[model samples]
Target: MTISLHRSATVLFQGDSITDVGRLVEPDSPLGNGYVRMAAERVLTALPDAGITFVNRGVAGDGVSDLRARWREDALDIQPDVVSVLIGVNDTWRRYCSGVVTSVRAYENDYRTMLAQVRDELDAQLILIEPFLVPVQDEQWAWREDLDPRIQVVRRLAEEFDAELLAADGLLNQAARAVGGAELITGDGVHPTPLGHTVLAEAWTELAGL
Candidate 1:
């Protein structure tokens, strides 16, 4: 199964700390330390002639607004053929913990605006990855109320933009149930462990149908 409409397209991953995972600042350093690297490696290995280049522009602790600010430099500049985004958890997380309130309306608006830019300016294929948090602790379980709507918004946007959707939240939830409820994966109920990253890579590969 092919993961892309174009076999040799460039794929770009964007979002917050989860996506960033300390990607090397230098151009020579291609893959990051997290799921991005794992997915890229698998793609390259499986489709050696596909010639897909993976770029991760996820900045640690970034919110949706931060992505908008750097979109030109980090995303559009690369001229990616397929762009995947996994953001919005930080928005809800900050509001839940730090009293840094970003309304759901604002989050949805910002996301739409950014996606519109990608559609009109770059003409790239979009992949909207739902932001997820496994409820390891009681407090974390409540995050779903706020985060779930945002995930729905991503689903809507993907349909509106004719982009592929990777249901990371659903995948993680299933994994948690199977693997002892998030303890086997996420370390802090937010960041994913290496095992969690492997799970994500497999999910992405399956979604891309590669």
Candidate 2:
């Protein structure tokens, strides 16, 4: 899919901690230190003359439901040309760690609602990224049961909404092979190490046609 960039474009990224990557949230530099930053850097270099505004509104530990609650302020208010959403990990993580269950139905419903809002409010293009879990440790493998369903939900939504889907699950898994299959991109199996973010950044740029 080719995402045609206009001379002056505004792009907004929304997601959880992996996306957050310790952004200051202050005015000077809010792009953070993860894939979002890497993606933005590539975009800037690719379109040096273009006036592209990049906004990162990723909050650590946020799920689909949280995104819905803050959609107005973080997303709608930005009124971006392309809105990239990478979410759903927390929905799966909370279940295993805290026994807080957010059913697949609930996950899909909330995600669909947020997409609808973006469609209606901004009429912006969508980039949907899948949530992934690489079992670097033995215990983390069990998370697949919960996370797989959510990944499918995101894929289904991407098709339904006519959005571009970044299959991060497959990309990250494939990336692990490069970094020694026994080792992981994330120490905890959730967050991405710098190497993991590089893989994601490259994949994201390719997906966005940057």
Candidate 3:
């Protein structure tokens, strides 16, 4: 699917570590080194006079609840003309690693709450990126049981909101397939490397029609 952008759009990127990529909370290149930065750079570089302002509000290790908590400040307050969300992996990861389970139902509820608020409060177009896994470890494979349901919920939400859906999970899987599941997609099956981020950038820019 093609993503359309307004002439002078204030684009907001929100989510977890994948989007964060060690950005300074202060200023000066807050988009970090992940897909957000890569995509933003490509867009700005391609059209220096597009008047597109990009903001990255992705904090490391954030979940749906975290997003809901900060929605007013990071999202709505930004008055974005377009909002892109790339969250939910942490919610699934914590279940196995930290024993902190966020049931699919709870995950969907929290996600729905945030999206509903954004819809009610802003005229921003929405782009929802799927939370994905690559399974570097055998245990990571099991995460599918929990994560799949959440992915389905996100799909439903995108349909309900008529939002643009960036199918990260499947896209990453397809990439992994070409490389035969090498650590190429994600060094640790979660956080992406620079090369992986490039892969994401290509997908995102194409999604944005940039």
Top candidate, metric TM-score: 2
List the RMSD of every prediction in angstroms: 2.0, 1.4, 1.5
Better of 2 and 3 by lDDT: 2
- On lDDT, the candidate that comes out on top is 2
Candidate 1 Cα outliers beyond 4 Å, as residue runs:
1-7, 24-29
TM-score, per-candidate, Cα-based:
0.93, 0.96, 0.95
Judge candidate 1 against the unseen true structure and give its global Cα lDDT, from 0 to 1: 0.85
Task: Residues 50-117, candidate 2: write the lDDT tens digits.
Answer: 99889999999898899899999999998999999999989999999999999999999999999999
Candidate order by TM-score, decreasing, is 2, 3, 1
111-193, model 1: which lDDT tens digit per residue? 99989989999998888888888877889878888898888999999889887888888888788788876877788887888
Candidate no. 1 TM-score: 0.93
Give the clashing pairs for model 1. none
Residue lDDT tens for model 3, 116-182:
8888989578899899998888888899998898889989999988889988888887888887764
Candidate 3 displacement at residue 84 in angstroms: 0.2
Residue pairs clashing in model 2 are none
Q: For candidate 3, give the lDDT.
A: 0.87
What ranges in model 3 sit over 4 Å off?
25-27
